[model samples]
Target: MSAGEQHGGRVTIRQVAVHAGVSEAAVSYALNGRPGVSEQTRARVLAAARELGWAPNIAARSLGTARANAVGMVLVRPPRVMVVDSFFTQMLSGVEAELNRAEVALVLHLVDAFEQTIDVYRRWYAGRAVDGVILTDLRHDDPRPAALRDIGLPGALIGGGPDDFDLCGLSSVDADVAGTARGILGYLRALRHRDVARVAGPADLLHTAQRDAAYAAAADDLGDLRYRVVHTNYSAADGMRATRELLSTAGPPTALVFDNDVMAAAALRVAHEMGLAVPADFSVVAWDDSDLCQITVPEITAMVQTPALQAELTARALLRALAGGEPTHVVLPAGTLTARGSTRPPKRLG
Candidate 1:
């Protein structure tokens, strides 16, 4: 037999299968570190391949060196909102800056439906269209993290919470969202605002949930604190609607904290039309400290969680995983409260 044939033709997958005492499919799964095969079987397959000096045939393997050298992201929002959202655009710029350094491309796909988002990931993985992926806007009981791991895909989840850790090949980076809410509430309370309101984003988001729970706890601590929360879809119109509802109430809030700068900006307009005086009749604080917070008549107080910096951190996490680093969870510093012109002590109403 020729040396190649004697050595099982330079170690085919079938030979590795026979040597590891596993099925060919298991060998394939094991070789790729897929979820189906047990760790023992995976190790055995790897050991057998190593002993036989069987290097991967990049031309034949799905996850070979001839990769796309790109990262994938699927955003679940309308195109107009994405275009207008300073946070998303700013975060994308940060993600791009980090990715550009390594000559890696960012392949962004926008999907409105949840099912479509999952399909995008599946397509990207099957086609080997990206070396890794970045996930954002994490929701409660999100399934994408696990789905990526099961398919042996590498990804970094941004804005995920504490419960998002420890998937097989998934990494995560998140700021302390709850702590941010606490700081906001604390600031409002210090202003002697007894009636405070929070205009929050979607209830299904994990980050929103964290903030919601923290808001509740802080309100509880401040005895005699009358608080209300209006959930919106992160739209300007929704912000206007929620703001109008609160202002029309018999006991309107003296201070308001909005989920994003867009909503906060919208609140300013609605407040003006309702004949409410800024920092006199009411106060406004936004979660994100975007440019929108500053350009208005009175600058908005904000919880300054730098979106660009956060996105850069998340991209670094994805790069680390792609370079063979073990998956890890990174916790970022909580956002800081920046006092501005839009908030003041509530006026005493007899």
Candidate 2:
């Protein structure tokens, strides 16, 4: 029987090599697009393989290539937050959708500390369990990017900005956080809210710093504005606490901005408990438009970040890095502010 009919049509590399009158190594180099084979030899081997219907063994190919066909993602977040937060769930969904198209697997690990997250990276590298990693929750002066470089592992950062592109020579995916912050300030100003308070996330987070700086700059540009920012852990309980303190202060802000939907929902409860009518006594704004934001008594006005699209872009950037491409910085369009029933001109600006 001809090489084409060998092993019931499951032609092997050896059969292709024999048919082309070349070494099996030459066939392999040619098939893998490596440099060992000359152009003429490569052409002949390719033709022979096609004629013989030779199909590569994926497992063998991966072993020879030292490729895991998988990527790792280590998140330094509380397990409780990850389970209850739709932001992370949507992010994972988007990342998985793109990776699925490339036939790649995702290894996800959630930890309470940054050190443990780094340890997971080291272990993953030693075991050759992943081709690269995806980083999230970028922090100020973060060390993980440098650590990945030291480990000789490729990675991409999510929530990066233009200024962060050169961080540890890694790829990055970002949104226009600064612009969004300024836009929110302007929108609130237009609603005649002169004194506003922002209940922000962790102060150490890079995005938080960016938003804080932007808010300060915008507030300065808009003269006669009074604003204060309270740092929290992006939790509902913290949100209620911060809101209660700000509302009970001697000179309370007429408007409150929360870093997340859960926090804004908590603020709504605090307002109710304090006998303050939303948008009449105070206004509420949230950063991410989640389901909770929509179902509140007075639907919350929010900044809309398309988490799915951002995560997909992040996955794509990491995949490109794995393919020997130069590190890329992808910045999606700035998030838009969606107004709902939760905001209006303050009765009397403080």
Candidate 3:
């Protein structure tokens, strides 16, 4: 049998170096297309590697001049959210689709806090476990970008606009929040519903802040409009509680908008429990479309942001950054509000 066959078909760089009659470091430099090796040495290394059917082990290659050939993403959310929210699943599908095409692996982690998330990044960087990272749920004056920059790690931000992190050198992808908020509020106003309240996600989140500002501006632009916002953790329980409180108030909003479909579904349950007629009593709108919206009683009006497309764009931006391309921000079209049985003129007007 040949010497190569004796190694059980797993040829190491050391073996290639020995076969090429060169130092292991020289073989590594040559194989990885680094600057230290001459063309003759590189040719010899390539010939030796090919003859032995040798392939670079990703972990070992990462220790040398070669890239890790993988990217990381951390979700700082309760584990339950991971299972209940289809948004992450849809977004991951898009990211996976892009990474699969590029032959790169995705290292995903779930953590409960930002501090833990940061620790993960530090550990990943120290171990050379990833080429770069993807960031989500950007917060006001977020320290994550700075942390990544300090560690010299390349990154991309999902769910942020062109105006975010201008100096930190992160590529970002975002939908047109200002336009989406305007569209949703305008539809309600057109239906003669002047008192509208928003069930928003965490106040510190950049996108939620953006939505708040946009909604406020839109409400101001429409004279005689009364707008209010309540913050939540984007959970079904919070949605039901907030919905119950708002509907219980003596002069509550004539319409309500939720940050996600799960919350909107909760709002529907709240309406039923309170004996309030959807659309006839008050209207409901959800941020993202889902099966829950359609299956719920009095199907909810919702905004479709096309999460898969958004995620694909974000993944492409990260890939470009990893390839030493200039970082750029990409903005997708705004969410399209789909009117359903859940919205109409207020009872007084109807």
Candidate 4:
């Protein structure tokens, strides 16, 4: 016998069968822990295995189980840039927490482009590399959910709209974007600001569309309040550029609202460079309040979006979806507004 076969004493199923006084097939069933073998036969097989010091091949056992014991996550952007966003980080932390409790591992894949994201999902589903998937950064007409549905794989969306595309009733968790926008507008209107300017994120995002629509509806309801909307790429640099352009206009708005804290902080810096005072000269309010809110000179008053809570809910929804439950739509209420020094009654124009 070869060294590889001899070291363990060539303890094959036939040998176990002879030692246990059972047929080879019965020994095989018992050794594999299959249900066909009687209890007495199984115990005899185990005793023979112990005497021979034989062990089942781990690789073969795993193949028999046919389970990866891991969940996949696909981020629709560059990993480095996505990690910088506190919202993503917090949400991921929440996912990790839940996954840890379940003793499962998270397999994260970052696709730099949209096409790449689609390809990654396709391959993952075909390969059966994960038990389920988590989809993030939903666009207006996302294809991942459909692909997952076609493949008969379980998945959950982190952000999506009610009427937006879904893959055969896949579960989705949406942030209260409309309510968030309305809350911000209500706060500004309550402060007696008649004109408000908004720096919005990418128009392709469903949340951005929802926010924009809500803001427009609120402004119309207020009666006589002027509204200006500027769409940007949700980056600090874009926010700074938009703020500069908006402030330099012929009739600059008295108050500015940003869709994210990164842009809001950039707007604060722009205000400082232009020698404009916060609140006294202009009021500002930011959505998705994060650490950046407190870092600026005049702390920004912002609408808080709890990423941790979103993540927890998303994890639970995904688990339920994986278990073949009906699709669930959870709409968490909008976060409370944290009042800071960045907003006040608009100043009198000269």
Candidate 5:
């Protein structure tokens, strides 16, 4: 309802117009900073509105302002995994905080299947469920960008721009995923570990692809050094199994890098079960340094990736999209090395 026809709130724009002795359109124009009304009339209308204690209802504002007053994020990952994943958990908290400051709401949903994710995105746009959306966990040749464009929905990507993903016409807040890998490998190399391996997340993810490429390049840089990448989900169980297999191999790596803390902790536990001493028999490193990294016998060394910062910037990008801001890119720096008990100079056993 406009000021004239109001419900829910105590004061209506009709009351303000009556007090100002002006037509409702004139009052609305003055109050909204539109050009139709003179400065004196605008001031009078504003005063009248203030005196009436009238506030725009968000529900009514949404209808008139072409805004849903909420942003959407549809996660392909399940809630069970999301709770344990420090990256998502911390990132969401930052996103929520930023959105709160803007007085916009968040509509977050998790899908049990990948197919449902596309449907949710389409429905959210077709039904005006959100003003804009934040896309994450992007994959190779992802179709969501194209789908979003087709439906006239606005979105901001969590990864890089056109170079990193399809992107289409969206802006992005990119993380230094490859740089993080380089930092991890560089640290291990400095510790005199010639053989290092990575237990990474799913291969299809764009970030994982970037990290994998970096790992390969780093291996090439260290002449005669051995490196291998084992793909796994960001799960403790997968981490444990991968660690067991890597350790069982002959002339296994002297150091290991995991995509996340959960996997690193799993690696640490497996190393213990195999009667191998951490930082001696094997050194461990994780991409995101979280609380899980410190709980182990030898606190895991990790890279200080700021997932919260990434999420904050990503949220801002979505806000820009909602405001019809031009598409652009923002690249964030990679995580720095955080040396801990789980890393040391290479120690070899016969």
Candidate 6:
């Protein structure tokens, strides 16, 4: 029988090497596009492999090398929510850029809940599907770090405390959410907004809780600041509904702050429908600076967190963890405050 027929129509690297009259190593180098093979030898190997219909065994190759050469990112949110958020998009862009330079691949897995994220990680680890994993949006007493530690898995965390948890020798990047809150509050105080309303994200979220605590602490010293906090689901519709409720109160706030730009834009629309001019009758500030900030009639003043920068930093951290480095914590500096048309001195209360 011919070599192809003998191998059940499958082409082996040995057959390709024999056909090209080259070593198996040379065939491998040529097929993998490595530099060791000469141009003529590479051409011959390619021609032989093509003729024999040789296909590389990915699983066998991975097992032999013991390297997946890919990083996995587990995001604790729905895919739709992740897709709509500019922060995630820019962060992913940064991650892709860094990984591209290293010739590594990024695998993003979006899960709706913490349990689901954990389940996916377990499967990936058991299957050896990734070289490393990345964790984001950490909560109080998070179970992920501990679970990874027990399994001796390599990982990196974003927005969580390193000292509190056993991170399985993984690296971490922390954003100072409390400090971010203080800065935003300071900005509003500078704008002379004593009566302010904050539309916040889910309280269970670590960042949201930190911001809430910071706002409370900061508002304490500002005598008569009269701050009100409203919890929402980080949606535009929720923001609109919260703003409407706040506006209907006996003494509505002269300024509003939203945890996300999506809700902030919704607040703008709500103000318009209520016949209140932006930065005139009321002012607004958004936490994340994104395209949504500029879409409104009056652009939103916001904290500009470079998602791409965050993503790149996170990627590097993951790579370091994969290289057998001890877990390290990196707290990036706070983002810049961009002043736009959405904020100003409050209107006089008659």
By summed lDDT, which 10 consecutive residues of candidate 2 come out lowest? Answer: 54-63
The number of the candidate with the highest TM-score is: 3
lDDT of 2 by residue, 1-350 (tens): 36536655667777777899998888877776556778899999998877876675642453277667788998876635533498888999989988987768899887888878778989999988898998888776778888999999999877784363347878878888877778888999998889999999989788888788878888998897899999998878888999999999998999999888899989989988999989899999998888888898999999988888888888899989898999988778778999999999999855
User: Superposing all C-alpha atoms, what RMSD in Å does each candidate have to the true structure?
Assistant: 10.2, 6.4, 5.7, 6.6, 5.5, 3.9
TM-score (C-alpha, index-matched) for candidate 4: 0.81
* Candidate 3 weakest ten by summed lDDT: 57-66
| Model 3 misplaced regions, further than 4 Å | 1-5, 8-64, 79-82, 161-167
Q: Candidate 6, overall lDDT?
A: 0.78
- Order the candidate numbers by TM-score, best to worst: 3, 5, 6, 2, 4, 1
Q: Tell me how candidate 2 scores on lDDT.
A: 0.84
Candidate 1: minimum summed lDDT over ten consecutive residues — where? 1-10
TM-score of 1: 0.79
Give the per-residue lDDT of model 6 (tens digit) for 134-177.
Answer: 77777777788778776666887766653445555667776766
RMSD, model 6, all Cα superposed?
3.9
The residue-by-residue lDDT of candidate 1 on 197-287, one tens digit each, is 9899989787788778778888988777888899988889889999999999998899988989989989989988998888898999999
- Quantify all predictions' global Cα lDDT against the true fold: 0.81, 0.84, 0.85, 0.78, 0.80, 0.78
Error of 2 at 290 (Å): 1.4
lDDT measured at residue 86 in model 6 versus the true structure, 0 to 100? 77
Q: Which stretches of candidate 5 lie over 4 Å from their true place?
A: 1-12, 16-63, 77-83, 161-164
Q: Which ten residues in a row have the lowest lDDT in candidate 6?
A: 58-67
Q: By summed lDDT, which 10 consecutive residues of candidate 5 come out lowest?
A: 58-67
**Residue 35 accuracy (lDDT) in model 2:** 64
Q: List the residue pairs that clash in candidate 6.
A: none
